[model samples]
Target: MNFETVAPNAVPEGAPLIDVREQNEWDAGHAATAQHLPASTLMENLDQLPETDDPLYIVCRSGGRSFQVAQWLNGNGFEAINVAGGMDMWFESGLPIVSDGEGEAYVL
Candidate 1:
C-alpha cells in the first residue's frame, strides 16, 4: 500500500504527531505536542494510538524508523504519514521541543 510523507515544517499544527523513538530518546527530547509511542513496542501499544480518521504523523530521530512505522500502520488501515527528516529536521527547523527531564530539550 502507498504511504504519505511530510516534512517536519509541513506537519500541521495540532495534528496527531506520534514519536516512535525509544524511551531514552524520548526522555532526551521530543516535539512538544507529540505523543510517545516507541516503534519497538508499537504493536503492543496499538490501543494507545489516537482514535481518529485524521492523518497520524509519525516521527523518529531521522525518519527511517518513522517511515517503517508509517508503512506498517498504513498497511494496517491507519492513515499514517511519515515525517521526513524526522526530529532532526524538526529541531533544525526551530520547531518547539520539550524534554521529559528537567534539562532543556535537545534531540537525542
Candidate 2:
C-alpha cells in the first residue's frame, strides 16, 4: 500500500482528518478537527470519504491502525495519507487535542 507521512499542521483547511482509534482513546484526546472513523468502519463507510483528489488522512493512537487503514484506502483507489505520529506523536509535539463533542461517534 502507498503511504505518505503527514504532519499535524499539514492537514488542509476543512479537510476530513480521519481518526482510526478506539472510542476511549478518542475520548481521551484527538486532533480537534479530526473525525472518528475507526479502521474497522473504514471499508463500510467508503462513501463518506473525501474526494479522491483530497487527502484521506488516517490516524490512530499509535501508527498500527492508520497503516492498516492507509493500505486499505490505497488498495481501493483512494489517496491515503498516514499521520505518522498519530495522536501520540501529535501530543509529543505539543499540539492540542479536543474533547469529544456531540457530533462524535465511536467505532466498536
Candidate 3:
C-alpha cells in the first residue's frame, strides 16, 4: 500500500488535481484547476476521471481522505498520488483557489 505523495506546491500546473472533499467544502473553495470528485461518491463517478496513464493528484481539506482515496485508486490499477497536507497546505503555500461563486476563495 505504498502510494506516492507530493506537496501542494510540487503539483505541476495543468495536472489533473481531484478534490475529494464534500459538496460544501468544494463550494467553499478549491484549487483553481481541481476537479470535483467527492470521496463519498468517487467510485460511482469513475467515468469523470481523466483517461490517461499520467498520475492523478488527489486532495482533501487535509491529507487523510485523499491519502485513502489515492491508496484505493492505486490498488484498483490507477496511478494516483495523495497531495500531502491537502488544501489547507495548498492555501498556505499561496496557490490559487476558486469558489463556486464570485467571492474570495478560502479553504473550507
Candidate 4:
C-alpha cells in the first residue's frame, strides 16, 4: 500500500515529526523538532501524539521503517507522511538536529 511521502527538508514547521528509530538512535541525534516515538511502541503510544489536522511525519534512520509506520497510520485513519530518505537526508540537508552529546552520530 502506498502512503503519503514528504522530503526530509520539506517537512513543515510545527508538524509532528515522529522519530521511529530506537532509543539509542534517538539519543545519538535527531531532528531538533522531532518527537521520540520508536516504531516498536507506536501503537501503544498513539494517544500521546499531538492532535493535528495536517499529516504527521514519520522518520527513522533510513526511510524503510518510517514508511511502514506511515502505512500503518494511514490504515488506522490517521494522516501520516513518511519522510523520504529519513534522518540521513535530514542531516545531509543541513537541518537542525539535536543530540544528547556534542559529537555527531550515525543515522543508520
Q: What's the lDDT for all of these models?
A: 0.94, 0.75, 0.93, 0.87
Ranking according to TM-score, highest score first: 1, 3, 4, 2
- lDDT by residue for model 4 over 1-108, one digit each (tens)? 557888888898888899999988998888888888899998899998889898889999879999999999999989899999989999898887888665875564
Q: Candidate 3's residue-wise lDDT over 1-108, tens digit each?
A: 667899999998888999999999999899888999999999899999999878999999999999999999999989999999999999999888889966888888
- Pairs in steric clash, model 4: none
Task: Pick out the ten consecutive residues of candidate 1 with the lowest summed lDDT.
Answer: 1-10
Candidate 1's C-alpha runs over 4 A off are none
Residue 79 CA error for candidate 1 (Å)? 0.6
Q: What is the lDDT of residue 42 in candidate 1?
A: 98
Instruction: Point out the higher-scoring one by TM-score: 3 or 4.
Output: 3
lDDT of 2: 0.75
Q: What is candidate 1's lDDT per residue for 10-102, written digit by digit as tens? A: 999899999999998999999989999999999999999999889999999999999999999999989999999999999999998999998
Cα TM-score per model: 0.97, 0.80, 0.95, 0.91
Using lDDT as the yardstick, the better of models 2 and 4 is 4
TM-score for candidate 3, residues paired by index:
0.95
Best-fitting candidate, scored by TM-score: 1
Evaluated against the true structure, the overall lDDT of model 3 is 0.93
Count of steric clashes across candidates, in order: 0, 0, 0, 0
RMSD of 2: 4.2
> 13-101 in candidate 2: lDDT tens per residue?
67778898877778767877888887777678777766656878888977778978887788877888888867877777777677665
**Winning candidate number (lDDT):** 1
For model 3, the superposed segments whose C-alpha errors exceed 4 Å read none
